[model samples]
Target: MIILASASPRRQELLSLICDDFSVEPADIDETIENEIELEKMPEYLAVKKAKHIQGNKHFDDIVIGCDTGVFLDGIMLGKPSSESNAAEMLRNLSGRKHKVITGCALLYKDRCISFSQTTEVEFFELTDMEIEDYIATGEPMDKAGAYGIQGKGTALVKGIVGDFYNVVGLPVAMLNKKLKEIISNAEKKL
Candidate 1:
């Protein structure tokens, strides 16, 4: 059985584009970036942590997938905002600038694990304070990295992206699909 170790509806929706057969098993862990992990490596670190956290309780053959995403600019990580004001500030900083959306994905089965991170460079049109305030008022930026959801109402804010568009959405479906195929092929060979 395949399981998703996340509570994100966006991730579940995104995963559907690649595979429909899976279960949700949200992992509760300290998602804070550790001092030892570099800013660019936080997503992969957290993703593996989340998967391993879930792995302890599942069947050996049950594969669990975990993912984490963050926005990075100038080597600093932009996490989910703490309040409306914070969201506004994040949006302001991203205005008319290019930032990276990094998503780390990990798949665990038995004692084996495979993990990778994908990054998509996204640019935003210069946003006015009124526009940022209006977006925040809609309550769409409250729980998203970079205070924007490129796949939702936030799409209006984005000018363009230079990598896998799905990576900005949350998961890199193309890469995930390819990885799963490899796992399945290897499993078949073993049998």
Candidate 2:
């Protein structure tokens, strides 16, 4: 069985694009440690941590997948907003700027873990204060990293993205699809 270590609906939706046999078992971990890791390494590190946390209880035959995402501007990582004004501030910081969205994925099977991160360059259209506030009113940015959801109304805020569009949504489907195929092939060879 494939187990997803997340509570994100976006991740569930993205994972469904590649695999149908799976269940969610949201991992409980203190994300505060992520604040200490280097910006570029934080996502993958957290993904591995989450997967490892859940794999401890799963059967050896079960494959556990965990993922983490973040929005980076300049050199600082922008995580989920804590409040309405925080969300607006993040949006203002991203406005007219090309920021990076990184989604890290980890797959744990048996005693082995494979992890990687996908980075997508996202350019935000110049937004006015009213635009940011109005979007915040809809309450979409509060739970999303970087205070925006590229898959929803936040789509209007993006000018264009340079990598996998799904990465911004939460998961990188193309890379995951390829990785899944590789794993299946390896398993068949072992058989």
Report the lDDT tens digits of candidate 1 across residue range 60-120. Answer: 6777888999899988999999999999999999999999999999988777889999999
lDDT of each: 0.90, 0.89
lDDT of 2 at 135: 98
What's the residue-level lDDT of 35 in candidate 2? 50
Best by TM-score: 1
Model 2: how far residue 144 lies from native, Å: 0.2
Q: Which stretches of candidate 1 lie above 4 Å from their native place?
A: none
Clashing pairs in 2: none
lDDT for 93 in candidate 2 is: 96
Candidate 2: residue 132 Cα off by (Å): 0.6
lDDT of 2: 0.89
Residues 1-191, model 2: lDDT tens digits: 78899999989998998898899999899876645678878888999889888988754567788899989998999999999989989999999999999999988877677788999999999999999989999999999999999999999999999999999998999997887676666656766
How big is the positional error of residue 49 in model 1, measured in Å on the Cα after superposition?
0.4
TM-score of each: 0.96, 0.94
- Stretches off by above 4 angstroms in model 2 are 34-36
Ten-residue stretch with the least lDDT total in model 2: 182-191
